[model samples]
Target: MKKEGCCLYYSRKSPMDDVPEEMTPIWSCTNEKCNGWMRDNFVLSVQPRCGQCDSLMEKSERLLPVLTNTSPNQKKN
Candidate 1:
């Protein structure tokens, strides 16, 4: 299984791979007071809120194939 974490950083990878880079969700927030930002794929169930602005953060972009989970019984081929 694979996992991802919340960070203000990401990489630009080529789209040739089966796991296309487009599948990744990108989030950004301008609220300086609050670190009010998080990715949908983040494991934590609680959503982050803007600390400084006291406002709800917003999703910036929608990526395809939101990878929710993987199964151990799945076929390798």
Candidate 2:
């Protein structure tokens, strides 16, 4: 059996080698004790609250897969 988390299980290369990545907007919890965050585009609110900590959130960015909003209510611009 190949180790997974404890060890990297790769075929030829890392699975994320060819995937695209970008600086995506996200909301991070202000409470240092909590590791809570969510993608900014996933929520419609101007200022979103942390769902895990229920604390105020701040805008931030993360290197994540390029995603597009699929919400039917989302307006095209």
Candidate 3:
């Protein structure tokens, strides 16, 4: 049995460390009270509306994990 109170462990790396990220294009809702956002290239619309608030979304960019979207809906013919 390990002594719980006498433990002196220090982690060099946090379990919740942020993933590798990059500046990526996205669309964000214009609503001031909404936090709706989505990746620009992964959507099916030319200009997507906010799914949460049904509000207008504008072009934006954010630091996010580099992702490869393999969804057929996102493919451009």
**lDDT of each candidate versus the true structure:** 0.52, 0.84, 0.86
lDDT of each residue in 1-77, candidate 3, tens digit only = 88668668897874644667789999999999999999988877887899999999999899887898887678533
lDDT of 3 at 59: 94
| Candidate 3 accuracy as TM-score | 0.71
In model 3, where is the ten-residue run with the lowest total lDDT? Answer: 11-20
Q: Residue 47 of model 3: what lDDT? A: 71
Q: Return the candidate ranking by TM-score, descending.
A: 3, 2, 1
TM-score of 1: 0.30
Which pairs clash (backbone N, Cα, C closer than 3 Å) in model 1? 33-52, 34-51, 34-52
Error of 2 at 43 (Å): 1.2
- Runs in model 2 deviating more than 4 A are 1-14, 74-77
Pick by lDDT: 2 or 3, better one:
3
Model 1 spans > 4 angstroms off: 1-20, 32-37, 50-55, 62-77
Q: What is candidate 1's lDDT per residue for 1-77, written digit by digit as tens?
A: 87987778565864545564454553445665555554455523244445456565666655554465454533322
- Assess candidate 2 and give its lDDT: 0.84
**How far in Å is the alpha carbon of 51 misplaced in model 3?**
0.4
- Superposed on all Cα atoms, model 2 deviates from the true structure by an RMSD in Å of 7.1
lDDT per residue for candidate 2 within 1-77, as digits (tens), equals 98767767668765786879999989899999999998877876787788997899998899998889898855423
